[model samples]
Target: MPDIVNHTFENMSTAQPHYDVIIAGAGPVGLFLACELALERCAVLVLEQAADPDSPLKRMPFGLRGLSAPSIGALHRRGLLDALDLHQRMKNPFVGPSSPGAKRPAGHFAGLVFHHEDIDMSQWPDQPDGLPASLLSEMAELETVLARRACELGVTIRRGAAIAGFDQEPDRVTVHAGDETFVGGWLVGCDGARSIVRKAGGFDFAGTEPEFTGYTFSAELSGAAALKPGRNVTARGMYLQSQPGFIVLQAFDGGAFHDAGLPVTREHLQDVLRRISGSDVTIETLHLATTWTDRARQATAYRNGRVLLAGDAAHIHSPLGGQGLNLGLGDALNLGWKLAATVQGRASEGLLDTYQAERHPLGARVLDWSRAQVALMRPDPGARALRAIVGDLMATRDGATYVAGRVWGLGTAAVRIA
Candidate 1:
């Protein structure tokens, strides 16, 4: 059984309901943080803007996310790893060589495939044998597991309560969400890239603009066979036909389409696909689609007085190597215990300040990493030459090992808080 805090204030109607921490956004990071704090006997309330958790984008190929070694280890330590079952049934869609004797595809760097046999396990001696360096998980399922765990730990979750604004006092933060108000000792913004808390708190979000607007969609296509099976880097842009109906394309449009907020109609996608793939692919029926860019940004400071930031609220980068989720999870794990210790009055002075000190550097590194990929993925001649050189290096043992380490998050310095 989980250790839960029994608050006496619930019986007092005259007093305002106060919690140890109020977290904005019920994403995996927020929910996982809630579970962490509640495990340490802290009262946590998570406020989420979304009313319903179900969304088509959170279901299948669109919802697919890669869990790195650090993230997997954190889940295992918390005993939440076994609850995830999607990996058991779903095979990795990212495939490599099909030759009978060739090594299987493990992961990729800038869409360049790396095989499992190429990775030197000896380099990662700390990672035990049979333990997966990475695993594929659906966003919806991961959230469900985290939300369940948070609830089990006695964390209160209020859905459909978007944080309109918040006022941070020396002792408490009063959050205005929808038509209701909530007061807590500390406020954490785990809300995504466009976090209201970050903006309202006046965090300096700094970084590079996007080079291109990428598209991921599911649609019925004619002449689908013209597209390649795996990731294809073309003269115009990059495109990947993961399955018959599922396709991903990157058009070097300087993020104009996405920024303009134009609807992703069948005509637009078909046009983009034709140009990027250089094929006359007709989109018979567009099913699901979403647009994203490689815009990299990070908060100069993760905290302002009593308000704090986590997940995409703290930093954002392209989903090039799928490092954003892992980075956010790392932030929650690093912050949870420290914040709980502070709230419980057991932490030494200046412990909470260390959250940004440790996490900011890591976040900056990830942003640069994504930026590097964007540079390599550009359609220009310089980028193509760089890609050739990088590809040659990636084929080597040392190169593969280094890339694998970064991709699997083994290269990151572990922040162990006991």
Candidate 2:
């Protein structure tokens, strides 16, 4: 079990609630936002549904998440960059043959690799110094680091307390979790995709339907040795074995199996793998499994009166290019200081509103980015030809640099849309 520390309010006996801000999730986004608020002396209370922070899915290769340039810069600015130790240890999958003058690959888009030699960093004249274009991070370690910082800065996190419902008034929001009621001057829902706060708050979630059902799992396989390594986008579907026994499968089921809400079983895994890989792979034992789809959706607005939304609560997309976490972290980063200034009465007339204005467009772009990947991932001759063309372009200097700039979330000046 993961170590869970819960803080109890000493004034529980009193009628008035003590917190200035109430957060509805203890995930990285919420925790980081709490750290930001606490840094400026705002009392924050984070309510989480999970009793423990540790999980098998958050460990090792399974939990591997790539940190983009912006994310690394945010961590460095907060003085927590040195706390990350995994990037130095994990083998860089993109590091090509170490022959003389070999170009290490930076990242990929829809499995099309981009090399560092092609990316012209000089294009980014305003780029900050001493920051890698990208880094690898584990989800569990990220949460642990952010959580520790939040606690140190006096943010109270209450585990096993899911926000059941909330009532927002003119000046404050009343949050109901378990049998207790906590009040805060403002509420931000950093809860995930199926956010209860979003549902209860009546936010409009708009997006495109899913094209396929995606699976990520670990299992014991008898004929796994027959399968090749790395990502393979087959006509039937896509399959990637980042490591032995750990696999990811994308089956074009029109998101049926995922929306069916059926539990993942060994039989299902075997069938999917065999069909996708065209190999008689037998699953001897199923260690872990989960299903998702490309059902991209985003809240029309991030704020609803005094109750606001962030992270997956505000937007959700396919985990293509590992952009889900990065996008959420960006939301927290963009909103933290703005919302903090608003809460502290230091914000200008429309500073608080800029959070939604700036972030909503970015969220839309990410959704489109995911959708574009899905379009190319289709098992058709046209998609295959397009993928090949994209691969060719990615090998070019200008193409790789452009994609790298977008992937690392760089080379954008704030533009006003009148």
The most accurate candidate by TM-score is 1
Tens digit of per-residue lDDT, candidate 1, span 159-215: 767789999899999998766688999999999999999999999999989889999
lDDT for model 2 comes to 0.84
Clashing pairs in 2: none
> In order, how many clashes per candidate?
0, 0
> How well does candidate 2 score on lDDT at residue 35?
86
The per-prediction CA RMSD against the true structure, in angstroms, equals 3.6, 3.0
Model 1, position 78: C-alpha lDDT score: 85
What tens digits encode model 2's per-residue C-alpha lDDT throughout 172-258?
Answer: 899988788999999999999999999999999999888899999998889888787777889998888888898989999899999
Error of 2 at 245 (Å): 0.9
| lDDT against true structure, model 1 | 0.86
